[model samples]
Target: MFIGGLGRSGTTLLERLLGEVPGVAPLGEVVHLWERGVIGKEPCGCGEPFTTCPFWRRVGIRAFGGWSTGLADRILTLRRRVDRTRHIPALAARRCRVGLSGYTRAYSRVYEAAAQVAGGRVVVDSSKHASLAFCLRTSPVVDMSVVHVVRDPRAVAYSWRKQITRPEDGTPMTRWPSAWTAVHWLVQNLAFELLARRGGTVIRVRYEDLLADPPAVMQALLTRLGLGGVAVTFLRQGVAELSVAHTCAGNPMRFAAGPLDLSRDDNWCDRQPRLHRWLVTALTWPLMLQYGYRPRDRRTPEGAVAPWLTAGVAAQECR
Candidate 1:
C-alpha cells in the first residue's frame, strides 16, 4: 500500500496503524531513503540509525547489492529527472515509461527487500507525494494500492505554519505561509485525484472519519485493499497499540510507539487565524466539498474546475 497525501494529513499515523496488522510492514517514506536514510543516516523508526538497523542493512544489501554513495547519488539523479511534479503530465499519459523504468526498478527493490526481511508481510509505504505515486504506478514489479488521505484544508494550513522539530537530526521542520500551503494543498490533493481517475486501487480516506471510528475505518480499509481476512488487531475503539516500524523518512511522529489515542484534534478551528482560514477555503472549496468538507462559504468561482473533471474524481473515489 502506498499512502499518499499532503505531509501532515495523518499518513504517518495511518501507516503505524496498518503496521500492526498481522501481515503488514509499514515503511515510513521510501521516497526520501536516498538522502535521509542512506546518505544522511537518519534514525529509523526502530531507534537505530538507518545504517545500523539490521532491517535496513539487509535491505541495502538486498535492494542494491549494498547501499553506497554512488547508488544513492545515481538514484537521486534519476529521481530529479523523473519524479518532479512537472513530470506528472508525461507520467500520467504513459509517455515517460522509459524514463521511469530505471527509477521504478531501484524503488521497487526497496519494497521488495523490506517485504522479504519482514517475512513477506505486505509492505506499506507512506511516501505521500503524488508525483512519486505517479511514477510507481508504472512499475512492473509493484502491485500498488493507494490510500489518498485528506484533512480539512484549514487544519493542514495551520500545520504548515507551525514550528516543529525533526527529531533525528535536531533540525527544525520546514514551515510555510498559509497561502503557499493552501496552494500546495490544492495541487497535491488534485494530483492524487488525477491518479484515481487514471485508474488503480485508489481510495479516499478522510482524516476526520478515521478518527471517529478507528477499528471500523481500518477494517474497512483492509477490506477495500482486498486483505479483509487479516485480523484487525491494531485499532480498538479509538485506541491502538503501535509497534516499532522501519519507515524511512516522515514526520517525527514515526518514532512514537505503544498505546496511542486516536483522538479528533480540532485545534485549528480555534487557533488558526480567520483570514488564513478564509484563504484556504477559497482556494480549495471545490475539492473540499467533494470529500465532504464544507467550506465556510460555498460559492465556487466560475471555472475553478471543469464540471466533468469534478464528476470524474468523485466517480473515481467510489471505485
Candidate 2:
C-alpha cells in the first residue's frame, strides 16, 4: 500500500500504527531510500545507521547487488527528472523511458525485498508523494493501493510554518509559507484524487477521524486492503507496539522508540495565526468542503459566505 499525502500530515504516525499489524512492513518514505538511506546514511528505525542495518543490508543486496553512492545518485536523479506533478501526463500516457522503467524495477525490488525480510505479505510505503504513488501505479511489477491522508489545511499550514528539529538528525525541518502550504495541500490532494480515479483502489483518511478512533479506522483500512482477517496487534489508546522496520526515510518520529501515545496534535487549531488559518481555509475551501470540513462563519465583503466555490469549478480549476 502507498501512503500519499503532504508532509507533517501524520503519515509517519499512521505508518507506525499500521506497522504493528501482522504480515505488514511499513517502510517510511521509500521515495527517499536512495538519497537519504544510501547516500546520506541516515539512521533506520532499527537505531543503526541505514548502511549498517542488517535488514536494509540484505534489502540492498537483493535490490541493487549492494547499495552505493553512485547508484543512489542515479536513482535520485531519475526520480527528480520523472517523478513530479508536471511529468504526470507523460507517465499516465505510458511513456516508459529506460530510466523510468529502471527506477520502477529498482523500487519494486526494494519492496519485494522488504516483504521477504519482514516475512510479510504486504509492504506499506509512506512516501507521501502523489507523483511517486502515480509512478508506482504504472509499474508492471507493483500492484499499488493508495491511502490518501489529509489533515485540515490550517493544521498543515501551521505545522509547516513551525521549525521542528529532526530526531534522527538535529537538522531543522524545512518550513513553508502558509500560502504555499495551502496551495500544495490543495494541489496534491486533488492530484491524488485524480490519480485514484484513473486506476487502483484509493481510500481517503482524515487525520482527525483517524486520531479520534484509530482501531476502527485501521481495521476498516486493513479490510479494504483485503487483510480483514490478519490480526491487528496495535489498537490500544496511548499505546502502539513497534518492531524493527527497514524504513528508508521520513519524519524523525520514525526513530521514536517504544510505545507511542496515539494522540491528536490539534494544537494548531488554537495556536495558528488567525490570518494563516483564514488564508488556508479560503484557498482550500472547496476541496475542504468535499472532504467534509466546515467553512468558517466569516463573511465576504458581499455579505456572502467567504471563499465559496462550486465543486465543479473547483475540480476544473484544480485540473
Candidate 3:
C-alpha cells in the first residue's frame, strides 16, 4: 500500500503504526530512496547509512543487480522530470510519453525488492507525493493501493512553519510560509482525490481521527485494503511497538526505537499566530468542510468528523 499525502500530515507515524502489523513492511519514502538514501547515502531507519545497511544492500542487489551512484543519480533525474504537481494531470490521464514508463518500472523495483526482503505480503510506502502515487498506481509490476492521509490545514500549516531537525542527520529542515503551505495542502489533497477518481484504490484517513483511535482506524483501513485478517497491536495507551524497519528516507522519527507514542500534535492550536491561523482556514475552507472540518465557530464538541465517516465515503470508520 502507498501512503499518499502532503508531508508532516502524519504519514510517518501512520507508516510506523502500519509497519507493526505482521505482513506489512514500512519503506519510509521510496521517492527519496534513489536520491537521498542511495546517492546521498543518508541514514536508514536501521541507524546505519543506506548504502551500508545490510537490508538495503540485499535490496540493491535484488532490485538493480547492485546499487550504483551513477544509476541512482540518473533515476533521480528521471523522477524529477516526471513527478511534480504540474505533471499530475498528464499522469492521471494516462498520457504515456518518453521517460514516464521507465521511471515507473524503476520505482516499482524498489517496492518489489522491499517485499522480498521484508517477507511481508504488503509493503507500506510513505512517499507522500501524489504524482508518484499515481505513477505507482499505473505500474504493472506491483499492485498498489493508496491511503490518502489528510490533517487539518490549520494544523498542517503550523507544523510546516516551525523549525524541525531531521533526526537522522541532525540537519535543520526548511520551513515554508503559512500561505504556501496552505496552497500545498489544497493542491496535494485535490490531486490525490483526482487520482482516486481515475480508478486507483484509495481510502482517506484523517490524522486526528487516527491518533484518537489507532487500532480502530487501522482496522478500517486494513479492511478496505482487503487485509482485514492482519493483526495490529498497540503496546499500551498511545504507544505502538516498532520493529527494525529498513526504510530508505523519511522523517527522522522513523529512526526512533522502542514503542512510539501515537499522540496528536495540536501545538498549532495554542501557538500559531492569529493571522496565520485565519489565513489557513480561509484558504482551506471549502475542502475542509467537505472533509468534515468545520469553521472555528461551527465546530462540534467532538471536533471534526472525517468525510469518510459523515459522507458515507469508502472505508468509513470514524465515530
Candidate 4:
C-alpha cells in the first residue's frame, strides 16, 4: 500500500490519514534507506528522530541485519557527508538503470525492511517521484498501486514560494520557472499515464477533491487497495508540526494540518505576477486543464483567476 506523489503534493497529508486506518502503517519517507546513504538529524514526522525512532530501528535490524540501534547510528553518521543538492540527478544517472533490474533491487530492500518490522503486506510511501514509480512498477519485488495526486499549479507555486523563502537569504521568492515546472509535471504524471496504458492497478487522485470531501476520497482509495471499511481518523494539526522542513533532505509527509485551508487552492493569484501567470498558462495550459483546472476565460468573472495545472504539477512547482 505504497502512497506517493510529487514533493509538496500532499504526500505527508495522505500518509497520516491512511496511517490512522487500522492495519496500515504509513511510513513517511523511509526513502533514506534507499537514498544511497544520505541522512540527517531531521526527525521523521512519525515523531521520532530517525536513528532513534523505534520503527526505523526495527527496519534497520530486519533489513540490513544487525542491531537496529547500531544500523540507525551508522546511517546517521554516513548521512552527514551527503550533499543534498546533487544527490538525486547523480544517483538517478549513476545507479538507476533505464531498465527494471536495478530498481527492483532497490525497492525490494526498502519494502522488505518495512514489511519485516511492520508485519504488513502493504506499505504507504508518500515519497512521490515518477521515475521511482516507473521503476517500481516493473520491479519483481513490488506490486505497486500508484495514486498520482493532482492539485492546482497556482496554489502549488504559491505554497512553494512561501516555503522556499528564507529570512537569512533576504531574497523575495519568485514563481517557479514555468518551463521547468511544466516539463517536470508532465513527465511525472506521464509516467503514471504510461503505466496505466501498460495495464496495471493505478489510480489518479485529485487533491482538491480529496480535501473537499475526505471520507469519500479515502474510502475509494482504500477500496482500490482492497482494504475497505477502515475507520477514517483525520488529524487536525498545524502545518509546521507536519512539515518535514527540518527533516533530512525533505519529506512531504511532514505537514501539520489545520482547519480546512482551501485558500491554498487559488493562492497563486495572490503570489504570481501577470507575466508569470501568462508563462505558466501558455506552457502548462493543455495539461493543467486536462486534470480539472479551468482556464481563466472559461471561469466566471468572480473566478477569473489564472489557469492552474493539476494538483500534482501545481504542488511540484510550489515545493
User: What TM-scores do the predictions have?
Assistant: 0.92, 0.90, 0.93, 0.70
What residue pairs clash in candidate 2, if any at all? Answer: none
Candidate 2: misplaced stretches above 4 Å? 297-319
Query: Which residue segments of model 3 deviate by more than 4 Å?
Result: 297-319
Per-residue lDDT value at 220 in model 3: 68
Residue-wise lDDT of candidate 4 within 210-277, one digit each (tens)?
66555656676776667866655543321211222222223433433333332234556655766756
Candidate 3 per-residue lDDT, tens place, 177-262, comes to 99999999999999988987787777888888787767667776776777776667654677887777888888878887787887
Instruction: Show where candidate 4 strays beyond 4 Å.
Output: 32-38, 66-103, 164-175, 233-265, 297-319
lDDT by residue (174-200, candidate 2, tens digit) is 999999999999989988888866765
Candidate 1 C-alpha lDDT tens digits along 162-254 = 999888878899999998988888899889888878986688777776776666666667777777767777667668888788888899878
Error of 1 at 264 (Å): 1.8
Screening candidate 3 with a backbone cut-off below 3 angstroms (N, C-alpha, C), the clashing residue pairs are: none
Please rank every candidate by lDDT, starting with the best: 1, 3, 2, 4
Best by lDDT: 1
Task: Rate residue 185 of model 3 by lDDT.
Answer: 97
Of 2 and 4, the candidate ranking higher by lDDT: 2
| Model 1 lowest lDDT segment of ten | 300-309
**lDDT scores in order:** 0.82, 0.78, 0.81, 0.53
Please give the lDDT score for candidate 3. Answer: 0.81
Q: Please give the distance, in angstroms, between residue 319's alpha carbon in candidate 3 and its true position after superposition.
A: 18
Q: Rank the models by TM-score, top first.
A: 3, 1, 2, 4
Q: After superposition, how far is residue 34 of candidate 2 from its true place, in Å?
A: 0.9
